[model samples]
Target: MESALAARLAAAPEEGIAPVHFVWIVAKDRASGTPSPMGIWSGDEDLTVTVALPDGTTASRAYLGGLGLEVEGLQYVADLTDNPVTVTLSQIAPAAQALVRGLDVRLAPVEVHATTMTGGALTSAPQLQWVGIVDEGPISTPAAGGAGGIALSIRSEIMTQLGQVNPAKSSDVHQKRRAAGDRFSEYAAVIGERKMQWYKR
Candidate 1:
């Protein structure tokens, strides 16, 4: 059910794209630990990014590192293994600090419908609808004079959600990623819609 990331981004307003956020939930079928079409399982109020480190002594530290947490006894170490990093976002800290790392959780396709209000333009723009998942999280830097922002890598959920529909394309890696992606994407779309809707309306 994942849609094209390129398509969605293209539809987004060039300006005022900041303060973006996506909230997601575990797919219903996935909630039961089985594979099925993606379904909404929860709301967006209480979702947190989970960072799992390698299964060793470095695990806990690695987890803290991704959060950009600087504690007395804990030193942040970078672990880049193709996965997106996780950070606890806040009002003041709109993004995750740079250097922390995490994996991108893949998922099944979920519908996304977004509405925007352009500065010069008067009325809210038409809703941009699509199906996709955020393959990665955004990488943020220092407030002024830094990487302006980060873009989530989104792709067609159908590209990977092939287990129950077509058992032939059975790959543990893809399935796991698909599930994660689904959870991430669904929440993202839902969260975005809710957040923007009030403003646009």
Candidate 2:
């Protein structure tokens, strides 16, 4: 739990604190597959704010677009376990539907924050209750004047990472990216095909 939030819970304030859920998705662009940051929260109005992340660091200020996104099946557990979560975007807005369909959201980083609202505003830093990756995204398009939705299936981040195949390549360029002076892979390509006579007949 976040330090401020834990203290608030311990204090047991008189004022009511409403629970709110916030989601941060690292979505990707359609064409370039470039990363795009989208912040969403279950609130009545949009907000630009920063919050504490689970990695013991402060996140950059995020603009959370509200009133259209929904999160489901989120759980907080004290044990070491991971579960999948689902996120859906209502298809009431055409632009939202288009945006969902246009992006390549596979393996996108997903984070869900749980916090409280006091006096119509967020309390302290929200605690990161769940972390995952986008396993798949399915969009449903409706007919003329019908309502559909875009749903994202999220799975455990550690599980996803375990299943991911390393894309590292054995080449000079790729090796240089890891360490500028490394030349271990310089002759990797040429040595593979080079023939050597090692027998004395």
Please list the C-alpha lDDT of all candidates, in the order they appear: 0.31, 0.75
User: Candidate 2 clashing pairs?
Assistant: none
Candidate 1 lDDT over 57-125, as tens digits, reads: 211111111222111111123642232222123213222322112222334233332232234221222
Error of 1 at 166 (Å): 7.8
Candidate No. with top TM-score: 2
TM-score of 1: 0.26
Going through the candidates in the order shown, the clash numbers are 22, 0
lDDT of 2 at 56: 69
TM-scores, one per candidate = 0.26, 0.65
- lDDT at 119 for candidate 2? 67
Model 1 RMSD to the real structure? 23.8
Worst 10 residues of 2 by lDDT: 91-100
